[model samples]
Structures are given as C-alpha cells and as structure tokens.
Target: MKKEFAVIGLGRFGGSICRALSTEGMQVLAIDKDEEKVNEFKNIASHAVILDSTDEVSLKEIGISNFEHVIVAIGENIQASILTTVILSELGVQRITVKAQNDYHEKILNKIGAHQIVHPERDMGRRIAHNLISNNILDYLELSDEHSIVEVKAGRKMKGKTLIDLDIRANYGCNVVAIKQGKSINVSPMADEILKEDDVLIVIGADIDISRFEKNLVIDD
Candidate 1:
C-alpha cells in the first residue's frame, strides 16, 4: 500500500508535521530538496528523499501521486510552493494541503486548485493572542473562520455553578464538551456536576459566542 502522507519540505512547519505523523505510527514519505534534511529524517519517516518537488518528472518517479495526502510545505520560496501544489493537483493527489507564506501565495494556490491552504504563522499568532487575553484561557483552536474551541479555567464566577445552573448551552450558545481537573477528564460531565475553581472547561461554539461567554465568566473575574 502507498504511504498515507507525503510532506515536501523540511522546514519548521513541514518537519513538525512529519514528526507528528510518524509519532502517530502513520506511513509518511518525507521529501525535501536539501540532503541534510533528508538525512535528518532518514530513520523517522517511512521514506526520506532529497528531490526538487517543483520538477514534475521528479515527483512522478517517487510515486508522489500514490500518497493519500500530500502536504506542500516549501518554505520561503513562493514560486516553488505554487509549482509543487499545481503538480500535486494535476497528479490527482487525494488531498493536497499547502502552507501559504502570505495572502498572495494563498490566492495563487487557490487559483491553481490547492485543496487546503494553511497559514501556520497567522493561525499561531491568533492562538497566542487568545492565550494572552487572559491567564484563564489555557488554549484555543480555530475550527473555522467563525467557530472555535477553547480550553479555559473555571474562575471565581463559575466556581460554584453547575452546568445547568449556568445555562451554558442555552444562554452562551456554547457547549461544554468536557471538564478536566488535575489529570482526570470527564468527557460526559453531567449538567448537575458542580464546577471548581481549578476545573478546566473545554467549550466549543461560534467565536463571537465564545468570546461573550469568556468575557462574562473569565475576563470579568
């Protein structure tokens, strides 16, 4: 069977993806134009190769089209990134996720048929900003442009309240999917379960609603 993923680049973003996928025991082919990078991941990925991904014939020789998902992570070089994404699209890679260096790069990638375009730096900036807003917000993940999932500490405002008493879903339009205290996580927490100051609530909803929910209970405290 073909590898499940192919990552074409060895920069911070691409290398991180390769490491995570490999750590998950997935079959990943790590490709890069730099020999040193290929050597670094030699034992990590299912296969590591030093090749110019922008060269169509080079990609075909390595059977790039066979991978179920291909990530174009050529760093800095917008030209190479666009060319590789275009070739991957033409080769009918089932899923092509490309890292956009900037807005212009994203637009060109979209025009050429990139299945998904990621702005890692931009997204990370948002995540950092959210975390900086208040110490109570432990983490944040963007589900979509308008939707997000946040892990926030239950502060003084929520310390003695129960899920139902707080009417989180009805009033805030956010769902408390889980609660964690210490190392224990309650994935299906009951509505009557009283919260503690140390509890961390994993909530998911529209970004605006989540912000409103946070402002009242988190920032207000």
Candidate 2:
C-alpha cells in the first residue's frame, strides 16, 4: 500500500518532498499559509491547502494526525516550525521529520519528539565541498561527525589492480564495500576482484582515513 504523507510549509524542501512522494505513487497533502505556494502543488500533490500549520485547530481541521508521515519544512520561522512539530508529536503522528535552521532549533525539535531532523543546507554544503576536493569522488554520504561513505571513480593507479594487491583496508583503514561497473554492482567485492578504470568503488571509513585514501589513491587527472 502507498504510504500517506503530509508536507507542511510548501517551500523548496517541502515542495520537493511532496512532488517526489507523489511521483512514487504515494499520497501527499501539501500545506502552506502562502496561497501561491499551496496552489503551486495543487496538480503535483494529492491535495493542497493554504493553512497556518502552527495553529493546532487548523491542523486538526485538516486531519494532519491521520497521515503516516508528516514533514515540517517551515523555513526561517523557527518558532512556527517548533510549534508545528510539537502539535504533531502530541497528536501521535507516526513519524515527523523537521528541517532545522540551526543547532538550537534542532535541539528543540529533538526535545519535542521529532522522528528525524534534517539540515539540508548544511549537508548539501558538505557534499559539494567533498566533491570539489576530490575529483574522483562521485558522491559522499556523511554517516556521522567522524565517519562517511564515499563513491569514487577508479583512477589510473587503481586500474587492473586486485583488492588483495592494493591492501586498501590495511593501508588506508578504509573498506571497499561494493564496486559498480556501468550498470552492475558487485556487493562485498572479493579480495581478488580486479578494479577497472571505469569502476566506481563504494568505500566507508573514518573521515580522516577516507581523506588520506582519496589524496593518496584517487587522482584528478
């Protein structure tokens, strides 16, 4: 069955989620106090409404608590975001994800029982910075403050080299979890597996170790 989702605050983050969920065939209800924003998602989402999400009465009228998941993407107005999150928690919503503007806002959201807190701007900045620093790094996923998983394209140094010959784990303290060649993915790649120049390696390790591996192995040109 398709999960039901309600996205409050039809800003960039919320609107994007609404459209994505709708595209995946899930039911999405888009809400915002801005009439123009609400109307913008009318055709994209299952339903769209202009309402003040911070008001408990307004939320109850729209039956917000019935949705399986609710995303509060209120931008700038931290107070409104917190209030809306508090109401959703009190109403026993199954899951509530909120976009936090800062550390203090995130702390308040956590205390109010938000299921997940997203720092989209901060996370995206990190991803872009990592990509810029390493030309071979195709993508980066931050697992924690100290750890990350990165996808790096195999460079000339890695071409035709078997995993055992490279001894990557012992040398760099990073593990190659998978290798992607064109459309195929080899999960838990064998030690004898030869890496091709076009292969994409999915590696995981501590941030510092990953940096060392990228600098020593992955090349720009």
lDDT of each: 0.92, 0.92
Candidate 2 lDDT over residue span 119-212, tens digit each: 9999999899988986788999888779999999998889999999889899999999999999999999999988899999999999999998
Encode model 1's per-residue lDDT on 1-221: one tens digit a residue: 53599999999999999999999899999999899999999999999999999899999999989899999988999999988998998999999999999998988998998989899999999889988999999899988779999999998889899998899889989999999989999997999999999999999999999999989877744
Span of ten consecutive residues with least summed lDDT in model 2: 212-221
lDDT of 1 at 150: 96
Deviation in angstroms for 46 in model 2? Answer: 0.5
RMSD of 2: 1.5
Candidate 1 Cα misplacement greater than 4 A, ranges: 1-3
- Report residue 102 deviation for candidate 2 (angstroms): 1.5
